[model samples]
Target: MAVSFHSRSNSYPSRQHPQAAHVDEQLTRLRSFEAASSSSICQRFSNLQDLHDSLEKMISLSVTNQVLSQDQIEKLLDGSIKILDLCNIAKDSLSQTKESLKEIQSIVRRKRGDLSAEVKKYLASRKFLKKSFQKVLKSLKTGQNKNNNALAVFGEAETVTIALFETIFSFISGSKACGKWSVVSKMISQSTVTCEAEANEFTIVDLEFQSDKSLKVENVQILEACIQDLEDGIESLSKSLIKYRVSILNI
Candidate 1:
């Protein structure tokens, strides 16, 4: 048999070969690490995309809500403007009415003054006439014309009392006229007012209301007083006339 020589292939592998195998094992480990890193990168990208979608939805919702709120605010503002215009109209109307009332009050004062002057003049004339009649009756009572004086005094007294009645009636009619033209009717009609408003968290507003009823009551009291004075004057004059007639007849 030929001498069998131990071939290198049948012996242990060389250091170089083992080194190559170790390199291959390391490359395998590197490839596996690269694959895992790629998977992690893909997961991160998907998460980012989902976040971007959520942000876009939030932005769209915010814009839609903002637009709706703006529309509502515009409608509310329009209503407020209408209310303000109405208030302006009411103010103008009230001003006109006030001017009219002032003119009426001025006319009333002039009439009241004329009536007062008339009453004073009538009272003075009546007083003078009453003195003259009393003097005539006194002279006749001290003389032989007593019966004639009694007749004359009775006639004079009747006339004076009748005149007094007319004056009192005139005063009553004047008081009634005052009541008719008084501000009571105007005051009642202007007192009714209503207003409503809407506001957010940052504003406040005021509505106006007015009244003049106290003025009406004051005028009514003045008219009542005039009536009372007329009644008292009439009663006093009647009593005086009767007493004077009786005295002249007794003499």
Candidate 2:
């Protein structure tokens, strides 16, 4: 969050301004994140936060320099709005899923509630989350292959930003990428993910409910802890997005 105002974009003697150079460095890190051998959902969320934090700094530095024309600013703002929408959806999904998990967990604790009903309720929530992401990820993949060179304003950065969002969303929904965006093709994780092929807390809890129609108390507690971690990550990202959006609006 190294934000400042009113620095001229060309004040630097180097090929790129200091802040802009940082943004490029962050973009490179994020682009290679999905290729890492030990990537996780939490790590993905943290990288996205870093990218936007750098983006905020770079944008603030150029607010008074007119580096981006009116049209470019408008397009950039539109892209920011899309990013915010995706972030909000991720937040909501996590919130709802957490509530469902807590409800089922409560019933298990009481040991007297209608366990069957609660199990079904939680699984239904999971199914709906997956379906929602299906539509979202489909739309995300629409033009993912289009040339980034066609756009001049943060083209590569913007593409990577959306890919990061998609990667997180897919993990939240307990699914795999549709192979359209190869950036996330290496999203294989042994833990801290919700992918069907991966064995994380969420998938373990989901399997217990679907196959046995009950949850072990210890398993419920573990899943709730995992959900809390994800909730914190999503909340942090949502704040970053909203802060960046507000900055652009002021510009």
Candidate 3:
């Protein structure tokens, strides 16, 4: 009896190979990592966008009033600098996120399973975030320009008002007419009160901006009212100065 020895088949078909199972496990872990990274990127973008909005509101508040106290002005400048720092951090994170996504996409493409849809979604979202950030940056630049203009205007107005006050004071001091001098003194006192009140109003506006809930419609209205009050006070002071000048010339 001739017995043929049985030979094992070249392929094992009863169970999955160890190498295939290991590859599948690795692929699963990579997919989970990809998903987690994508979520993180989305969250970071959202946080950055919120910060951008806050910065814009702060800028608006800073530029609304021209006559901020030195302390208040310093606070605003510090706040703006902080915002810029935060923006830079966000930008760096965004860049890192994009690089991570690119590396993941390349890995997914080489893997057995297709992840084109997920990768495409992340790429599109990144594009949208880039555009949004650009727009916010443009707005920030515009706000800075406005602040500079407001500062210039404030300086000019302050110089003129100070000079006018000095001229009126000197004229009143040199005058001999008691009645005219009395009227001028009263006008000067009223103008000083008006100017102080305007400054107080502006301070209140600044306090509102510094509050936790700074971006309210009510804050905007308050700022507008303060600006109006400031304008009226300046106008009244100018009128008082004009009256003092005319009185001095007549005397």
For residues 179-217, could you state the per-residue lDDT of candidate 3 as single tens digits? 122211433445433433433322332222233322344
Off by over 4 Å in 2: 1-15, 35-39, 63-65, 143-153, 175-197
Whole-model lDDT, model 2: 0.63
lDDT of 2 at 60: 68
Task: Please give the CA lDDT of all the candidate structures.
Answer: 0.30, 0.63, 0.34
Tens digits of per-residue lDDT for model 2 on 121-156?
887888788889889989987644233222232556
Q: Which candidate order results from sorting by TM-score in descending order?
A: 2, 3, 1
RMSD in Å for all candidates: 53.8, 7.8, 37.3
Error of 3 at 235 (Å): 48
Top candidate when judged by TM-score against the true structure:
2
* lDDT (10s digit) by residue, model 1, range 1-251: 12232222222222134433443343333223311122332232233223223222322332222322222323323322332332233234324333433443454566554433443343343335335434534433332211122122212222222222232222222222222222234433322221111210000000111123223423433433433333343334334333432332222
Better of 2 and 3 by lDDT: 2
Worst 10 residues of 1 by lDDT: 200-209
